[model samples]
Target: MHKTLSVATRLAAVAAVTLLGACAGMAPAPVFSQDSLPDTVKVPAGHRVVLETVGVGEITYECRAKAGDAMAFEWAFVGPRADLNGRDGKKLGTYFGPPATWASNDGSRITGTQVAVAPAKPGSIPLQLVRANPATGNGAMTGVSFVQRVATVGGVAPALPCDAAGAGRKEVVKYQADYIFWKPA
Candidate 1:
């Protein structure tokens, strides 16, 4: 009886260890990955490029526009954005947690042949929220389907503080994208 009890105890310990290993090896959360495809963006006008980053909470875009264009670099850590009716209310992340960036020429008015805006990097979320329709004189709005590829969020695409950056900002990994926006013809 004593030997049988000892064997049972050992088996239980082994089972517990196996269970723990399985839990620890669980797949990573749905947080966006660096290889994740980027959302599509359309160039809206003709002029020079202006970097535009839209972030919420601590998640911010690590971005740059055409090289040598000082005005081509801009990033924003936005708090929140709402519409006139205020119907869709979601978490700050749900709205802009995935750090996405875009660019427009100074004289751009939001209409033209769209071009590739930027390239994905190691620690970045490359995205382009192209407002398909430029404001029309008739006050009409036509939005394009959020494209995923030509523009993307390609960094440590954090889902939320609870995601890959919760331990601390220092512990979080950041990816930078190489953007390529040329003048529109």
Candidate 2:
């Protein structure tokens, strides 16, 4: 009985260690570099990078008729729902929008516009070059000038057909991307 109890305790300890290691591997923090920013996200001469965040989100889309046509299917961006993470895997904020907003831990936020887009890998949303509208809060995002959504994975709109009958139908697509925020140097 003593030997059997010892074996059971050893097995439980091993299982606990394995579980902890797996959890640690689930979502490793992202690495960043200025040189790694995609060309699609243009940074005007002398503007410096202020912060970079890694975002995991769903890019929502709505099925509607193509513009200028009444019987076609087209996917239109509704907005996004994401959790922004810092380099240490800490939750920094949440991103959501019709006018994309990045609200950080310290209550700072910024909105932006799509200035440019580049092709992304198959099955993923296109890389975006966004220009910040202006800083709203007095947080980490204050004075932010531009933002880039790159290294995209998944989040493509579904291939559902949309007619006038399906005009308002919505779909949520899963995606992950790195968002780099910039400011004037």
Candidate 3:
């Protein structure tokens, strides 16, 4: 009987420790630093990151004439369609549209105007900063003030020939980028 009680107490202590460890793991995740990014893509002073998401999907480009020169055909950006995911790889939202919208799974959404952009590495999309418009539906996006797109891997316009023969053609390019959301501190 004595041996049994001792073993039972040890098991109980082990269970308690396991529970405490799990609770500790639930603490708020540490925010990522933006210091390594270019000044043009950095969030403004007094803003804090509220979320970090990786956007994975495709950007569409359409073969069209250059804005100022009809004779100069190129791939014009159509828009983007992507899944926004948390660091843990869970789908948290989506990014899409001609108007450039980001929508959270909980129904919150926002559009933004481009603030600036800096070139990323070769063959990658540019790093970008955007000023968020007022959010709709009220959730994770409610107070978002800015978004920075970084760590780009692809999503450049297609390398295929864009000429009069291919006018109006559309192509999709895969891309992955880290999108950090921020709000006033």
Candidate 4:
């Protein structure tokens, strides 16, 4: 019975590893370029390419009072989560927060402002043009000047009816997008 239990445990571990490998293998390759960016994501005249990360995350929303008469669900701009990955399917870091931050594995971090937006589809979250904060870390994010989020998928919250009774109700919606960083040429 001891031997049989050990064999079953080994088999389960092997199956788990195989499943993880398959998921990694199925990650899509990065496929966008500077030329493919939409006009809304305007890179300044002197900025040059730095790096791009493609990954998936969530966009959170909460029910809040709109104007004076009604309650509506709107983006809370915080608490969304994403795993930023490299072309080889290795995780490099994470993207999160209301101001929208990309924190890299090398201890570098940066935040950006949404200067422009173009909706990905009818209901999906839009691709965005973001202006980066001055680089503060001495890692991959050093000297970063601008960032663009494009080729997004998912991340839209359901259109549930919200009223005064539902104020403060929160929901997390799933999403995906490519984040491209740039620096002055």
Candidate 5:
């Protein structure tokens, strides 16, 4: 009985070590670059990129009267629904909402206030910077100080006319952007 217990303990220890080693072998998160980004969307000094994710999904828009002008109508910005993926193309989390939440699969999440935005290429959505609030839960989102949205593609308002005839109609436009999360250096 004593010999059997000793062998089992040794096997468990080996398994634990192997598991830890496997985790350590995971590829490190990719580095972020801002050389081509506009100054308005750049992460502020003293922060370093901690995680970089690609957000691939859609933005919803609604046909509504232009704010402050009842006579004018347009496709108004609504919200986003996206999956955040790592460089390896694995789903790491999600981004969505009117409040704009970024949630990690590890159960960590954050909501942030928009800091600034700059126009991207003609057909793409603007690049943006956000200041993250204190994260809820823990894990990947903990200690995030900022989030930058760059490399935007096709998130602009729908091309459909937004006249009174289409009032209350909703449309979803496909988009992709890179979200780089930063922490104080």
Candidate 6:
């Protein structure tokens, strides 16, 4: 049963990779060069974030601020886990990046891409901020301390398990993450 569960998880993460493939083109940017900006300028780079896909499930993403000016950033999916697996290790749960897809949002909505597969493969996921109609934020992706969630639209969610159900599709349960950016004074 444990072996089956592991296989299922792998399959799920693969599914997620396929899903992000559709949105691959719209992915944001990658990590900036070491000298892109001054050492004093701290931009949101790589940070683990928990995000919900509303009706889908919860997802964990390594949210990184885009190198240049962007309303969003890159995400590295980590896969998902559930409160408790059902009889067949199948249950409503969350999925994170396998290092394939990345997700992000504007403290409201979230989205991403699968640069690689298996939340911890060997690549990064793309992400962006949830922007309203006509996003009007600065192109600069600022560094931030984000809280990912499996549910809760306005709350910060935590990270999901790596070897739970649905590791392939890596579905995020719902709004359960929070991200806060510290403005430079």
Q: What's the number of clashes in each of the models?
A: 19, 0, 0, 3, 0, 69
Q: Is candidate 1 or candidate 3 better by lDDT?
A: 3
Give the Cα RMSD of candidate 4: 10.2
Q: Tell me the alpha-carbon RMSD of every candidate.
A: 20.5, 8.3, 2.7, 10.2, 5.9, 23.1
lDDT of 1 at 81: 20
- Write candidate 6's Cα lDDT for 10-38 as tens digits: 99999999988877867654322323223
Instruction: Output the worst ten-in-a-row residue range by lDDT, candidate 5.
Output: 1-10
TM-score of each model, paired residue for residue: 0.22, 0.76, 0.90, 0.75, 0.83, 0.19
Give a tens-digit lDDT track for model 3, residues 48-81.
9899999999999999999889999999999999
**What is the alpha-carbon lDDT for the whole of candidate 2?**
0.83
Q: Rank order by lDDT, top first? A: 3, 5, 2, 4, 1, 6
**Candidate 1 local Cα displacement, residue 34, angstroms:** 20
- Candidate 4: the clashing residue pairs are 77-98, 155-174, 155-175
What is candidate 4's lDDT per residue for 10-121, written digit by digit as tens? 9999999999999988966544466766788768788877787876877878777766545344434446789998866789989988667889999999988889987687
Our model 6 lands, by Cα RMSD against the true structure, at 23.1
Give the lDDT of residue 125 in candidate 4.
Answer: 77
Candidate 1 — worst ten consecutive residues by lDDT sum? 78-87
Arranged by TM-score, best first: 3, 5, 2, 4, 1, 6
Whose lDDT is greatest here? 3
Better of 1 and 4 by TM-score: 4
Best by TM-score: 3
Candidate 2 or 5, higher TM-score? 5
Give the clashing residue pairs of candidate 2, or none: none
